[model samples]
Target: MPNHDQLPTDEERDMLRGSVRGFLGQHIAGARTVDAGRQTERQLWKQLANLGLTALGTDPGQGGLREVVIVQEELGRAGCGSPLLSAALLNLSGVVEQANDERVAAVLAGMHTGDHCIPLAFGEFDGDRSAGRPALRSDRLTGDIAFVEGAEGATHFAVFTAGPVLTIVDADAPGVMIEAATAMHLGGQSRVRFADAPTVRVPLNKDGVDNLVAIARLGYAARAYGAARRAFELAVAYAKERKQFGQAIGRFQAIQHKLANCHIDLQGVELTIGSAAKQYDAGARDWHWFAAAACVLAGDALRQVSLETHHTFGAIGYSEEHEAPRHFKRIHLDVLRHGGARPARDELADRFLGGTPDRLPEYDLGPAANEFRGEVRAWLLEHWSGERRAAHQQPPFAEREYDRAFALDLGRTGWIGLAWRKHFGGQERSAFEQLALMEEMERAEAPRAGAPVQAAMLQVYGTPEQRRKYLPEILNGKAIYGMGYSEPDSGSDLASLRTRAVRDGDHYVINGQKIWTTTYWGEYMLLAARTNPDSKPAHAGISMFIVPMDTPGITIQTSTTMYGGTFANVFYDNVKVPAANMVGDEGNGWKVLTGALATERGFIGGGIVLKVAHAFELLCTYLRGVETDGKPMRLDPIVRQKIGDLAARIESGRQMMLYCAKQVDSGETPPHDAAASKVYSGELMERFGEVALDILGLEATLTEGSPGAILRGRIEQNLRHSLMWVISIGTNEIQRSIIAQRGLGLPR
Candidate 1:
């Protein structure tokens, strides 16, 4: 039923984007100047029809929602307004539902040629048509329709009314009055009043109207994304050229971080919109849900990007002559078209809170990956479900996150090294399969397995003997590793660690104190210490080693974490590790350490977000049966909105993870992308925890084993634990700096 193969390739989409962009570039001088009156708008609509864009919504062979998205985005990028949303998408969708009716068929045919301009007046400002629906008695329409776009020169009005019927009424028909309403960013909005106006009824159902609105919302979101992206580009260009204090403003970390944040926000908006379009094209059952989620996220993220873009540009950006203002207007106005994000959020809340509770949509990660996901799901069902999972989950939250027996069982299946290379004793599976494995593991709430970072470092930089001894140990669950990069004072600024490892005859005598050593109980530590302390760059003096935890001088002082788990302040006093255990050449530890860190951050990004998703799922499940003050919790408007917001953000994080995995599959070690993923996902976990508590109230703060605790007190524990994700694996602030420097090419 879902023909993903029919979807456009990247090259095809690129070509389409180029063509649309080039066309817009030629016609529209600027966004603010695009509203040249009704006649000019009509002329542009005809041009779009000639280019086959007007037919895209009606003819599957011409193109589909994806093509529409490209056109809309280009329109927004150029800061030009078009009737694509109104005439092409909304009205055309309604007409197609009643194409067998001669009047509707004629209207649809005229629309393809850009000869008809029938904007649908189906809803109020808040997207509720039912509230003030026109009386549709005796085949006549009566009442006022508000917030109709492109109504200035429309050939007819497709009015949806109280009987849930669609009627085509002539703009100048008896008792019909069209009056200019308040201006929007794009202009050409009006109110239409009909006092028993004569009309032709086109048979259509509420489903048809819902579909029409969904299409319009998606189109508007694309436009918002395009506008936000253009604004960000303008800010970046200005930052590169705007000098301050004797250097480019972009060189400043403040500017860099601001622009980097805009970049991340744009990524979320773009990815969500793309996924929604693809789902719509595939005829997926949950396509509407995807559409709503896209709108909600785009409305929030793009709006923020637009605002931050101006913030980056400073005073000059506020000028109407500058490009930023137009895009800002476009993003704000376009996103709020179908009652903005609120209505979309309400739609999502209805689905999530009203029913048996549906799971998040599963993305199509390709055939091999799809099949592999199924296999992983089945395997998880068999190996880690019911009583065993219950028993594993009974411990304090942090302690339950990993299990040796489970890790050993999973390691025996060879899945722990799924994405490692072949020569290094791995199956060398695709990254998507690896993602599938991680996703399924998180979905099943299974314990983590193996030392992936240590295994990766050994595969790349370890000596031959080291690899032989250590690789299998990590792969077969025979060993685990503690990271020894941070000291009491050197956490985020890891290169500044005071750890020292002086080379002796055949061993490295290490002396350092590492704090927050999460795996201090493991067999070995992947340690980073300064070897050439006098080296000019400071970081170049570092070296990496594998130190056995059982070394005579090693002392572990464990401290309890706020999340009820323990980490150690490990003191390595005259500990002797064989020089043969060194991961890479001495004084090259920065590269080796960063390489391992990159891998760790990539999965950490994925792992943290997946954990939030699992927790969100649990929260949703709990809310479905909850009641307060005599009403269902799910029925509470505040509860519905919060859950909807969480669902959309979680989806955005999921897309970001998939994007990072895609980069890895393409042979790219995307450190910046990984950083972006890490930053967004880590922060999202924090936000989700807060929102869970807000919705669940005080009971959510209860601890494990407490009387009448909610979700075994996991919600509050997660709220506390979320702080670790943002702090561990490098702080979010550090990740933002990486994104600025590496992702956006901002000056350090």
Candidate 2:
């Protein structure tokens, strides 16, 4: 299977996107109009045929659903209407399935050449029962089909009946009447009434119908994503250029955060659609699930993004003449097609609440990593399950998250430093392999292991002696390092830290205090102190040292967190550290500090999301078996919808995590991308906790040991724990600034 984690960089795909975008740029002017008339629409259809877009998915060499997605996105981006989705993809799909039939072959040929506009009229109108599926009796059709897109100027109609049969009928056949219908958007939709109209059977079976429907859903979702993307781009541009209060509005934190959210939302829609399409092309059996997920997220995300875009554009965008309004209409209309998000949500709810592999869709993390994931999973089952896991969980909740003996055991397997260089006693595994390890460990709810950040720093900047002393201890899980960077007054603003270190002979005398040190009980502290107080910039005078926590004159005052975890305010009153303990040159600690912090932030992003995913799974398990007022909670429509939404968002967060991991594998620091991941994932955790409580009610708020507490009170504990994720590891507000400035190039 293709590496869907990476952005599409193939020359052919790039050329295809570029050519389609270029065509739309030149031919389509202003906001698209549905009243362009049938002749103009046909002319545009012929142009698309010449571009080979209509031939997509018909031949393996030409392209498949992936290519079709690209064309659909471009069409949506331009706010241009086309027959690509209805005639080219949907109708063509039916004809291709029955290509052995001479009549079907003739229609397929005409479709490919753009000489025929054959719209597929399948299923009932979403949420409207006025028009229902046609019936097939004795090779004739009689019924009314509604919302048949691309029905204007059509030469034929591919009607799917309740008999599970696909039949082709001439548009002008006797007793067949097509009337223009008012639609939510400008697409040429019509209602067709058939009175025993003779039909030609297309030989499509049940599987064929399923396949076509999945593709149609994905196609509509792709278009919605494209429209949302275009609207976001326009809003960003306007924010950059439109001035307010003597500066670009983009400089305002309010505006910046809004656009930042839109960026993240767009990523979710784009990645989900791409994943579904790629999986379909690879012939994965679960592609239908992904398609449903894509549609669900697209429908919800685009609607919000559309509204936000207009809000950013203000009064000007409210006008129908603005380009933004066109995109708004297009997004709403497209996503609402093909049964909308409700049916898709129901499909997801079935898989999640049903007893069959009750988990979210698995991502394809490439072959090597996929194999490694299974290996890690099996290893966890052996080492962390049954009596061993039960014994570990017997401890207090906060302490159970870490176990020295278990960490040492895992370290012995040589997986602790999987991504470290071989020179540093590591296996030198790929980043993907490391990601697999992280995922499996989190899913297994295993205790945290490895001192990855410290090991990484020691490898990059440690002296030979320092490496010899710390590397083995870290790799063997014999040592843990606590970060001593945040002082009471210098949390996110690390440069303002006042901690001082003065040289005295061969030792540095350290004096200051660090607050919120969660790992204060660890063996050593990664300390940052000011060496030259009078330097041009305060941070320019900072230096880093690895100070032993047992050093004299150091004091630790511990306190319990609201979530029952312990952290300390550690004070250093003239503590002495050996000069040799210092890593990197003096006054360059900023680089070293940021380097380690970046890695931590990336993992923090992934870790938080995995926690959310696991918690969501537990909630689903509870709902599956629990009853409310004599009814199963799983049967509740509101409950199902809520679960389905969370499931889709969780999948999106997983994709974002993988995207960041791919960036790391490419040997780039990717600070902004990591920040995006961290911000989105962290906030998602908070949202999940709130939604869980809302879904499960007061019983969910009971403490862990309380009687009748849901999920053993994990839901409430997690809700409290979630507050720390967003606040620690750099606040979500700070991360948003990073995304706005670094990712979007917005003014600070």
Candidate 3:
């Protein structure tokens, strides 16, 4: 297994996730079906937002989009109100030229200035065949828009029209009517009508006809990410609380398998959305087709997740008071609001020459992929050592000495750079072999925290001198690196970083800040800084640097998160470095950063997450040992059901991890593998935490070390940590955006 000094590929993130188990056990409320409008319980949202989510779409000059995305999923898990996500997406829209009118710009800008309500009005799918035009009209918008979610509190609506006539209308416009609609979702909706509301006019094909639709599709996908995340939590929570035939239902095979299916669907949809978001953010032309497909996939995904979630709860899920009904209501209402399922799909087919018949070539995942898997597994077994096994027993966020030693062991065996080029201390193994190794590691529940992804990326794109300096450190384990791409205001937008590095003769003076630097204590950090402040086209003037953690004037201030890890605010106040320290050429930072995640953004715990999965499995074994009234907890169907579901999710998460491995083994980057893996794995971790807490009942609130606590408080820990999984990395919303843009090729 890989060690903590390594970072897992996006596909392998779930491995080290056990850190959250303790939190979930302690903080996540016990699982008795959550009440409707429990939305108020989302104290987690306020806690995280202050952690600085509003700045995600802004630049280093403002904040970051990555953390915003990460925070987005946590909000989803909590099922809270949000204007941050929409603002981030809308900001991206403006950047890519998708926002056509003045109204759109104001709407987006308003979000950053304390505006908490921004709703979008794309026509909802009624699951109908009526050819009738939308009864809603713009004299000005004289009739009701059939279905809209979150509209009850909207200040403005970004309305999508058929022709070149999009607009933003005030919710309280003159002659406007807002009737609370009978939506099936747990979140409510409304039918908005205008007798003669004044609407701000915008272009339909301002950029391209397909562009607006793609943008609209992307928005839905984002919302779906929010919805699906909640639904998964709902089902998982229910599985643990409801018992049947003398055991927890969660332990039952039938319920577990059903949740597994939902897990898979959730992963797929999340992947679709992530692909789309990436395409839009990167300004990939000809991405409309991809965006449409992603929308369809995302749309369908929420529906299935919502439906399965309800099914898992049976009759209890049906009660209006149950959270399951709320999730279903959101799914059904949102499903139709944008384009139903087919508009996005049909739009996708129209873009493809053969109507999406030959859309994406099938990734070879059969014999060869499996064979590659076997080879890696065999190799890992052969290389298994005494210290490595011992290291596995330590928690993922354990003391650094243990992680560093374990990482050293992996480096010694040459597994750390098994796929690296020999010239630079790597084996220069084939891409397939690299992927094969990852597959084996993930399935084996191997540690992956400290892999040299940051270093290797620098090597691949850095100047020769830069490579000479850091490549050895990466290989020898003297300096494991962490990514500094994210900052308070600069998440997904690579070009907007404001960390500035200036030249002063022989040295480059770095002055600025980088936040969300994951391994705040790692030996070295790969920081992106602005070398050319006025470089045209936004992304053209950046440069990469290998900055030491203890560099003078460079302060790494740590911020604690509810998830238990401390991300740092790395401040550089004229920190001086030799000009030679710059990675690649000065002003070539964009090129270097572009492929930083070409392999993957990384597993949630990077190298250490899989350990959590193993720990969760251990928790499950212990859960089976629990009992309340003179009977083993395993005897209760619902308890069994919840545990069974967790087991299955672990399996599915592993499979998704493998699918990414297969893609890598096939010699190409798995486009949506990370998104697919991250969403499911994150949800899986969350569900496990929630279920464990629920099965514990009132006793669940007791802390792990508290007197008479059940499962040693493992349930509460998992419950709290699950929320972290939702927000970390690219956050599920950002992942969905990537899917919609990259996989589906939708508009901005």
Candidate 4:
């Protein structure tokens, strides 16, 4: 169970998911059974046992917690009222590895055949999973345990105490009574009062306790993930079918934006759970915190998604007859059952902020990439001083000399284009290594490399001449690039750009006006212009050229952005470019443009996530020392909650970026993947800025050199900068369109 790499292959996992889904659909995909309590799907239980799910964690040869996660998710989706989690996972899986013990062996063997109905009673009054502490006395167990899952159907109970000790007790033993308890989900819980119930102690070490808690948390998260997904599916279907004002409600931006946020939330939860499961399966010590993080993150996401989905369904959703209400109630039950999101988040914060100095989560980018991170981190430690960070704190839209110096130093070290060919002055590392480099640079608050667009595109689609002419200059920090794709009226509709490139004797004459060209101080511009006005599709006629910025008849007029960065309006009136400067085919600029965009989105997406992480760290540090109401700001419950929210979001964005990077390295075009990351990251930046300002209030507006300004007033700068991300690199609206069309395969 502790080796994720040894789990079933993707095809195998999918097959397992499909089989489980099919089974649940047949048996559990209807209205809930009206049974009040202690009811069991005896036949369905036998079928699950037949499917080998009951003994999944008994041996590696059978399966592990990964398989159990899949099964539980499917069960949740089907609204199955089964005790699989309590009996199979919590009890059987917990002791299966110690099968040599007579009791453990008997339980595991009988549980597989559905003959042993054992429920776990690990919590006391208030049912907080983390609140119980019990001690054995005179060969008897005395405690009032609450929220014992599946207790009404149990023949025996496995009770855990804070000594982290385990004890087994027969349900019929004297002085034990079970009271039927109401639950939010399909099954019922029971409050068990045991005064001097006969018990037998079971051995459990501290590590074993950690594993049990971690596995249980992961199980709940998986279940929540499935429930949230089902709710989302229902919402999406309803949005498409339900009409309002003579149109499907899904067509409205209000609904679309809400669903989009839900999509983002669930997707992030999916990745976080996957990461946590893998870490747990690998038996990594940090799995303890990661499991808790997963619980907190999933619970929060499920809560929002459940609310939105129910709202989407309107009146019908609120009725008990509808299925959505069941899922919504289940979401509440699942989350609160495991000490809820609040306590789970507090635990995560303690692990993060209270650990030893330098305690941080590992990137898990593998050995070579980690080595690269180490090298880059070491370099930054030596060079990125407090003064340098201060000097580089200018608006992202502004050109600062300190950024150039830092880039130059990195160039000299052969770090620029580290994943490119060594012959082209790159070290030929993996895409992940390059991402690691970018992540650290952003985390360090150092200047980012300017205009890697041309370099990145050239590595994939550039001609030999193009690579030789521009790549060396780019790697040496001698060439900066500005994009000349967006025209005044074209913007997101770049295929309809009016910029025309006409053939002349041995040259192409360019005529166009490009506005909002970022980093316009570059030495060169990748200008896209119409080469064939007669082509059937307008985009098919577009062509790209590498035009020198200082060419005759080219004028650059700088405009200041609200974020304090500078862009330019570049007018190319009859500017001539050598015919050889054309990139790819004369009328294939759309292909080149799109290819370049996928990579650019990755950089933009990844950079923003790390930037938020850096900003949050600063905000937390400030809160820790600053006073609110004569106490440290960190002591405020509201402030601590905000910090937790920010941390979860930052981690999600980080994982999304890693996924995008991995997609690129795997040779997939995955525009939808990049768009998802881009949209989420940009919007997350806006949220971070808003919350940081809320916490700091008027003090947050202080700029550089102000006495007691936080992070040199970068918080104010970030607020100004946040909106630009949503507008630039194709507006988030455009990205959502891409996601709907490409990722979800919805029609345009």
Candidate 5:
């Protein structure tokens, strides 16, 4: 609660992370490339055993559940193939969950020892079974369960029987044929076949299907999170190192702002996976739907990170050796292998329409979610009219001034500190309120810049003086601030930043280079620097300084992104700041940062970014104007499909975004909801960019300033800018780790 930067506290999270990370480090990290695309990694399994990664799903009498989930996450990270998924689902839980046999315990034991691997296979294309009728001996799962992962080494198969039944079989048995490992996305995960495999009988009636689906969905969600984390990490690392125009890609306002957006998305991902995992652990049931949602977000996150990491890396990332292609491939496989994002839609539709509607997770927004809706609606009606709508319609994401205003308005309305305690500029809102407010903002397309997150941090750790000085400035629209955290040499390893501030009587004279300062144009900046580098720990010696832009000896050098505009490189040469301007006690910067980032479940995917909307609008307008390939480009199935997919992603993203908002509104974090949504929304934007360029063909090659440039080359600009969204923030890869580690209690 102290900070968004504060790390997770659960011991299960740390232990799981260490165990799985150790396993990957020992086995797959340096494995030879047995095959270019498809690796039949036999030696890899024993290593997983040596590190005790395979038996994670077993009850504590054997090992731990958290460990197994971490293994799933690691599997995605390493892009290493393993059949432990099968063991956990089918042999360990699925088939036994239905049968009353001692074999269940034996299989569970085998799984713990890595004696056998088990996997389950059921798909959207698994042929329709006649309702309430017997599964024909010949029906035999007539459709291919495409992109099935972990079946290669599965000792037993748990096949989804029609309705609520599970049919189990030995993978090595007659009628079950193991096919050569096939290539998909990521690297080694594979797909195999039934080809009329004989069924293991499940009686006509049973209810293990739900359990079976949960195991599979949750596993994939973990995998997705892992992949997303790697993608995000790669993006962030790439942004920090990759130079563009004349400086690191990070030192551009457009890039830094985009990265801020990316960070929000990553926070969302952490919330989703963590929430879903908690539910699973609680035996909350309905893990099927919960895990489904997590996967949807994970897929979204993975796709977004993969695309952006490549963009951030440019040509280097595009080449096969860069690891970007493999990560992208993994995203596609994990998403499509299951019913894809469509199932999430079906699940949501079913939750809202199938049940008593009133029974859908009683969103206890304290004042019921609808109550806040009514109140906000009343407030809007009383306040928002022609002038207000006109003023607000300037597109929240694009209007810098309005963005600050939105934050001020929300602060005035007491919505900005919805989650903080009433004692300190907050309403002490519940998780539901926080989530609800976020959803409301998204729905209203409200701007959120003035609040700048640092306000929340101040509430947690700011001295009374700091609060009095800055909170009002933030709440009102008087002061705008930039995050001057990263410097020339420090990015991910932020503790090592080199900026310095020396004590000088009533002030501290600071001098150093600060790059990647977002919105350097802002009036005030939150600068993290070293006040005592000789102090024992690097983290402890740091301090936060609130320096006014007008301070003497400060030169802000601007760097343009591949897009446009700048994130400035700030040079503080003996710039004096009063000692009173410090945020808290000196040598407490890291502590303050930790407090700031704790429980930071938030927006995933960039805000309904204007860049994406602009791209879509432009593509639509272009499609209407001309024909391509002998037919209007708008009419082609591929074009239509891309558009259709984007629309679905957009809509789903909106809901997930709202869901994330709901969690935030109630004063509860929304990690799983946020991560998945952010991932999906960001990726969808990239997808739109790629599809738009393909449709534009040569037209996209033109620069905006060129004589014959097409539509001022907006598509090209968007393509270039989209990379920033994925690379900034947590990077999709880091997001996945959060999901896997914090969300699912998986091994890191």
Candidate 6:
């Protein structure tokens, strides 16, 4: 009985974020300036209670899990320890909603008035917290529970016992001993010993135990995310100000790449947390899967960002005076606090592997979008068979007629320009629909709809005349475009090209040699050349035009690529193009080119994510069926760990792509985010291919047509094609610079 529509509006979330940020700044500024060991002041906790944050999520209008998370993140960023998460979110959240126990109800009611603080101690050394363990108990409980958060501040302890019961015990009750333990983070913990302590067992079931643990795990994840975010910001600031050889370290490729990775990790944590919160708000029973996923991924991210940020700061970060160690310590504690990575991975794998194959986490595009995905999937399953995939899968960087033919077939259905306006021969679909199309096409390994993509770009920056001349043919699947931006000298730096186009009455004569052009099969070349050679900045005076592929003086020499694909070294010797073919007014090509570049980066990135997902699935499926030494390879401990890690990373990239698409749909131009997606996914492709090959061993090296070639040698083929992902669409290195400068607000 999940309410799929229960998500908060963007405006409402923004307002909540602003108010929480403002509150933390006003009350916690002086506190953060001090060391991490000091506890959150009682006055500040009272102020939080006064604002009703402790009680905000109990009612629909007051907010829900998402609102609580929003407040938690800001509090964590401030390094403040008010026990809001441990006392309110973890201990009292579901209890207030589900139970009628008088003591529980009284504790919950008093929590909002800052008169009570109850800490959860469900974890024991021997048993799963959700499934209670054996303890010294006849009528009272006796055992030691480890890592009980907020233990030092608790007035009472909510302990889970062998009865799978939630027992409420006074902190100072007979036989109770609380040994204080030092934490690396802001909060305090204790080893709570119950030597036959008097206890009140509340009515609770197995489901209730699991729900409590899930709440605790998720709330801890929010705090970890905030700490990691702060760490990344600190790193970026240090990189910009800390001088290395001569310039700021942020200008160096090494630092930029690492910081960029930090950003990617933080993004994954944010998205996963948001998804889990929404699931909880909607009353989804499957919310536990998301909670587990978030904890595992967020833990790794927090650990990674903390380490990298510390590295970026050098020795100063290791000092007690710096804030980096505090965040670092907190990340270590949180990562291991709630069952750690191993157990979480096992939980996720059980859902995906032990049950139905359909348990694999696919993007839930809502009911309408799911219907659209089904329609598209059905069409693809019918049309794109094994044979079609083989025929169109002509490695990376190749342009095949078979691919174009398939695209033309899709274009006929009005699916090619789904994101374009309806009047422009498009369906005017939602971004989610477009994303669904991209993901399905990638999963099927179908022919890329590249030609129609250029047509869609034309809809954005093309002149009306240009659209009228070329769009119809493209819409009807007639014309395809080859890019003409990169020259022999320019790669990612597209503005420094030496190609020149001079006006000659009604035509412009073009002379340039373009390298790495993959659109040789297209009907037209979307060319970029300089019209004013003397313009102050090299980027200015650039012009874009549509040149006929069959124009007299044009020559295309094909070069074989490393990945078994082909690139066209297109040369133009005094080629003439009509003035009407120019995309925009003279000197406006830079704007047009950069705009198109952003779109291309965004969409190209979408495919890479799905490709990684497909590769991971293929690896899992192969290992599941095949055996070594009469045992399934999937059963090997090392193999399981490797695949589990890969699965998490792949899903992370998938979430990143979806978020970028959402930004585009909202009419925000996020070039940096688009670049981040490309950067993370491109490198991820390389890593996945490497790890998969390693796992599959020597037989995986055989090429297609070999007797025992695995997946028809697609694994080896992917190893070579992975380079194209990192190098093409803008090199991963270039994308890192974009992320550092634009996304992190660092200098170029």
Return the TM-score for each candidate structure: 0.94, 0.95, 0.49, 0.90, 0.51, 0.92
Poorly placed runs, candidate 5 (over 4 Å): 1-9, 30-43, 46-69, 91-97, 102-105, 123-146, 185-207, 242-265, 283-292, 318-321, 350-748
Worst 10 residues of 5 by lDDT: 125-134
Which 10 consecutive residues of model 3 have the lowest summed lDDT?
A: 353-362
lDDT tens per residue, model 2, 1-748: 2233333445878899999999999999986675566688778778888887776766655676788899899988988767677654553354675568787788778888888777776653233354467888888988888877666667788877765677788888997897877666555667888899988886556666667776787888898888899989999889889999999999999989888888888887888898888887777878888888888888888899999989999998988888998888889888887777877888888888876547866677889999999999999999999999988877668778689999898989889888888888899887778778888887888989778888888899999999999999888888888989899899999999999999999999999999999888889999999999998788899999999999999999999998878899999999999999999999989889989889888767877898898889888988888899998888899988998888888888887888878878888856777887888888899899999988889989998878888877889998888899988878888888887788888887
**lDDT, model 3, position 725:** 67
Worst 10 residues of 4 by lDDT: 351-360
> If both were scored by lDDT, which would come out higher, candidate 1 or candidate 4?
1
The TM-score of candidate 4 is 0.90
* Predicted structure 2, TM vs. truth: 0.95
Cα lDDT listed for each candidate: 0.83, 0.83, 0.57, 0.76, 0.59, 0.75
Model 6 Cα lDDT, one tens digit per residue, 460-525: 778788788788787766677888978878988888898889999999999989999876767899
Residue lDDT tens for model 4, 198-317: 876666666666566556767777887788899888888888888889888877766776777788788888887777766766667676666666777887888999999888888979
| Candidate 6 stretches greater than 4 Å from native | 1-8, 29-45, 88-93, 97-101, 125-136, 185-187, 242-248, 386-401, 450-453
Predicted candidate 5 versus true structure: per-residue lDDT over 1-748, tens digit per residue? 0121232336756776776776666666433232332224435555566565665444443333344566777777776656666666543343445556566556555655766555556542232221112232543643344344555545665556456455555666665565445455233344445556665455423445545555566666677657666766776666666676778776554544444444445454555565555445545545445555555566565567666556666687666666566666665666554555555545543432332321223223445666886676666555544677566654322333345545556557866666566776677756555556554454454445455467877876688988988887776655777878877678756789889989999999998988867578778888898999898878889998888999999898887777654678899998999999888789988887645543443653436433354355555655655677686555555555455444434444544555666656565664544555555566667777787777677877787666776776667766776776665554555555554445533322
Candidate number with the higher TM-score (1 or 3) = 1
Prediction-by-prediction clash tally: 1, 0, 123, 2, 76, 0
Write model 1 residue lDDT over 1-748, tens digit each, in one string.
1245665677887888998899888988864555356787678778887887777755554567888888889988998766676665543354665568787788767877888877776643238443246778798888888766667667788777655677888877899887775544445556788899988876666776778778788888998899888888878888888999999999998898898888888898889898888887888888888888889998889988888888888899878888888888778888887677888999888877877777777878889999999998999999999999999987766677678998899888888888878777789998888888888988887877799888989888988898889898888877889899888789988778899999899999999899998889889999999988899798999999999889999988999999788899999899999999888999999999999999988868888888998898888888899889988999998998998898899888988998988888888868889998899998999999899889987888989999989988889888888899999988888888898888887777
- Model 2: worst 10 consecutive residues (lDDT sum): 1-10
* Model 5 alpha-carbon miss at residue 42, Å: 5.6
Lowest lDDT sum, 10 consecutive residues, model 6, at 30-39
Rank list by TM-score:
2, 1, 6, 4, 5, 3
Give me the candidate number with maximum TM-score.
2
> RMSD in Å for candidate 1, one decimal?
2.5
Estimate the lDDT of model 4. 0.76
